[model samples]
Target chain A: MDAAARLFSERGYHGTSMQHLGQALGLQRGSLYAHIGSKEELLFDVVNQGAERFLGMARHAASSGEPAAARLRALLVGHVSTAAQHLEASTVFLNEWRYLSPVPRAQIQAKRDLYETVVRRIISDGVAAGEFDPGVNVAMAGRLVLSAGNWIYTWYHPDGALSASAIGAELFDLILNGLAKEGPA
Target chain B: MDAAARLFSERGYHGTSMQHLGQALGLQRGSLYAHIGSKEELLFDVVNQGAERFLGMARHAASSGEPAAARLRALLVGHVSTAAQHLEASTVFLNEWRYLSPVPRAQIQAKRDLYETVVRRIISDGVAAGEFDPGVNVAMAGRLVLSAGNWIYTWYHPDGALSASAIGAELFDLILNGLAKEGPA
Candidate 1:
């Protein structure tokens, strides 16, 4: 999967083939087919797995008993950590999913929208709870958070000055303070 | 340039060719070359023009006599508006620059880095002026702001609920309030 993710990330989904995947894996093309259903299926698996990791974390965070602020913080941490851990898959998920066939593409989009909904709910809750600026655009705030988390795949490096945890914490601090800025603690 | 940008955005840079671009513009392959030097040159032009717009705004904001917070707000508005106005060009700039030959790629990378440095300077200034949390990571905070602005190209729609100005304003409000949350106005 990692090898496939790297290839897809580097060469793009349309540019990659079953034969290429087979070559990377050092398996015969015929043997590769026996093991993996098809190239599209492999793409679906990679994209679906990446989406699931994110959605699962979002669900857990949203379902938590904590306050909206803490819940949002947890969501950021989960998002950053997951992307950092699966950087290549996350890159493929972000960049290559556009090439997925109609059915799988819609499925992935739905899953993505679901994750976004959870983020929106957290912001809305914060606004309602008087923990965030009432004037805050809930949709925009949600997108901002997702953008911040999603884009880490582009720049987050393992050997960089900050660990993934530290990066997540910094993002949380920036966002939490921003949303809660005009509100009373 | 617009034609090239749309083509590149829809098709991966590698997947696109002079024939594809020429067809999109209703030009013969030979005629296209007569008008435009080469596909790489077009890519560089598209990417360079986009970067220049972004960097121009960042430089202006950075050099302004306004307070760091206000300058940052202006920068967001500029970044978001430019991105919304030229979504395809911005998308190509962000996603397709990777396919540039090494020399042009480095040139683009340098411009991008320069834009980032301006953003970082703004954050550092805000911190120094006690207008933002002193503990803020300048580099990370800058990236957060850029991510929020850069990713606008991905989801921004001209006929969406918000106008480009409104969207920019919302982003500014989010970043401003977030960064200045702990600071006294």
Candidate 2:
């Protein structure tokens, strides 16, 4: 699975072939076929695994029983950490999932939408509790937060100056406090 | 060019072939060769055009002479608008540019890095001018802003509820005011 993730991440799903997967796994075509039903199955498994990881973290954050602000921070931090720890799978999940057939793709999409809903609900809770700005657009706020979190896989390096948690903390601060000096003009 | 953009965006650079390009353009392979050198050339052209569009908007925003807050808003708006307007090209540019051979890939990378630098410089100037919070991490702030901006191409629809400019304004406001009502914890 790690080898599959690596190949899918390095070369897109369409670009990676069963032959490539077999080579990466050091298995003959016969053996590879015995292990996995098909290339799409492997792709589905990899993408599904990634979706589960993200959804698992998000669910944990959502049910943490913290205030909205704290929950949001935890959510963002967990998102960044998950992507950093599983960079290859994250890349495949973000970039190559579209290659899945309609049924599996819909399954992944549902999970993704649910994850977004989790983020949105946090912001909605924040607004309702007076913990967030009254005028905040919950939907857009959720998208922006996910956008920042989802994009980390594209550029994050394990050896980079900032750890995943530090990067997530900084992003959370920016999202929570903003860049404006005196608030909105 | 439109056909190439659409095909590249749909099938990805590696997944696309000269044959597909010729078929899309209703030209024979021989005739297609008369007009272009190779499939890579078309990919490079499409990706390069997308990079140039993004850079053009970012440069315009960077040089707008507005205060940091306003300039940042303009930058985000322009980024969203460009991606929304050139959806297929933007898709290819963002996702398939990595498939370019080393030289062309480096060219696109430089432009992307330069665009990120433009974003960073805007935040830095804003901080120095007292329009933005002094404690901001300029780099991470820039990434957050760009992340929200760049990810738009993935889901933006022309007929969506909000126009590109409207979405950009909302995102800009979120980045400026944040979701927290009482500011950072």
Candidate 3:
């Protein structure tokens, strides 16, 4: 899965082929079928699994018994940390999912929509509970938080100056305080 | 340029060829070179011009005599508005620059670095003037702002619920208040 994700990220889904996968994995062309059925299936698996990881983290965080702000914080941490830890898969998930065939594409998008809804609900809840400003645009704010975390995969190197956790902490502070009411809740 | 950018965004850079551009433009293969050099030149033009538009907007806003918060607001408005107005070119600039040759790639990167530095300095200045929290990580905050604004192209639609300026105002409000010092500047 990691190898497939890395290749897909580097060369793109259409540019990579089963032969390249075989070369990378040291498998005979005929023997490769035993592990993976077809190139599309591999692409499906890589994309589906990648989406599942993100959606799973978001689902778990959204359902946690924490306050809306805490839930949002947890979601941010999960989002940035997962993207950093699974940088290749996150890249494939972000850019290469468009290559999936219709059925798998729909499935992945449904999962993505669910994850987005989870984020939206948290922000809306925050707004309702007065944890966030009442005038906040729930949908736009949700997308902003997700984009801010998602783009980290584009530039956050594991060995770079800041670890994923450090970045997450800074983002959490920035976001929560940003969303806070001017005076007090 | 729009056709080329849409094609590049739809098809990976390597997957797109001179023939694809000619077909998209309804030009004969031989006549294509009369208007554009090679496919690479087209890619460079698309990416560089898109980047230039962004950097120009940022530079203009950065050099304005506004306070840090107002300058940041101008930058966000410019960033999101430009991306929304030039969706196809923005898409290619965000994703297809890796396909450029080393020289063009470096030129683009240099411009990107300049943009990044401009944002960082604004945040750092805000911190120094006691407008934003002193402990804010200037570099990370800068990337967060860019990522949040840059990702606007992904979900922003011309006919969507909000206009580009509405979204920009909301983002500006979120970011400025989020970075504000505890009591007063």
Candidate 4:
């Protein structure tokens, strides 16, 4: 899966073939079929892997029993961590999503939307509970959160100065508090 | 420019050729080259043109006589509006940026960094002025704001129910005040 994902991401899904995967795994193109049913299956598996990881993280974070504000932070942090942890698979989930068959693609999109729905609900609850700004727009807020979390695959490097955790922490503060100057809490 | 930009963005950079641009414009490839140097030049020109628009908008917004919050609002709103006004060019800027030559790429990147740096400074000032959360991480705050702003291109539709102004306003509140319920202002 790793070899397939790396090649597919670098070369693009259409450009990758079974022979390439076989070479990466020290097998002939025909031999790969024994282990993996089809190219689309490989893509489906990789994408689902990442999607499951995200949904799992969201579920775990939701059950953490934190305040709504803290829960939202946990979701953001967990998401970036998952993206970093499964960089290859997550990259496929994010970038190669178009190559999936409609059934699988819609399934993945639904899960992605579900995660955002949870985030939106959290923000809405936070607002009602006075843990968030009253003016929060749930739709834009969810998309904004998803955007920051999703784009890390484009720029983050393992050896960069900021660890994923640190970056997530910084992002959490920025999103939760904003950059406005204010008196000390 | 819009026609060229649309082609460059919809088709991959290398996938787009002078011949195709000519076909779009109803000219021979040779005639297209007379007006344009090469495919790379076209890309660079489109990217530079879009960057200039964004840079102009940001500079104008930041340097305006409005209050800090209002200026930031205008900056964010103007960007979304400009991107919508020049959707094809903006999409090309976000997606096909890599095809630019070294010098042009660096220039655009520098301008991009400057825009981000300016936003960070504004956020820092806003935090300092007690109009925002003091604990905000200005750099990451800038990234969230910018990324959230740019992602509008991915999903926003001209005929969509939500206007650009509404998105900007909602996003500004999300980034500045957060989802936390407002205490007394």
Top model number, DockQ: 2
Instruction: Evaluate all candidate structures by whole-model CA lDDT and list the values in order.
Output: 0.84, 0.91, 0.82, 0.78
Which candidate leads the pack in lDDT?
2
Interface RMSD of each: 4.9, 1.3, 5.2, 4.6
Misplaced by over 4 Å in model 3 are A28-30, A179-185, B179-185
lDDT of 1 by residue, A32-145 (tens): 988878888888899999999999999999999788888998999999999999998998888888878899999999999999999999889888887777777889999989
The parts of candidate 2 lying over 4 Å away from their true place are none
Q: B41-130 in candidate 3: lDDT tens per residue?
A: 998999999989998999899989877877888998889999999888898898878768789899999999999999998878777776
lDDT of 2 by residue, A107-146 (tens): 9999999999999999999999999999999999999999
TM-score for all predictions? 0.92, 0.98, 0.92, 0.84
Tens digit of per-residue lDDT, candidate 4, span B24-118 = 99999888878888777888889889888998999898887666778888888888888888888998887677557689889889988888877
Residues A29-147, model 4: lDDT tens digits: 77788898999999988888888899999888776777887888888899888888888788778867656878988998999888887888887877778777665667888888888
DockQ of 2: 0.77
On a 0 to 100 scale, what is the lDDT of residue B25 in model 1?
Answer: 85
Poorly placed runs, candidate 1 (over 4 Å):
A179-185, B179-185
Error of 2 at B90 (Å): 0.6
Chain B alone: TM-score in each candidate? 0.92, 0.97, 0.92, 0.93
Ranked by DockQ from best down, the candidates are: 2, 1, 4, 3
Quality class of the docking in candidate 1, CAPRI style = acceptable
Locate the minimum summed-lDDT window of 10 residues in model 1 chain B.
B176-185
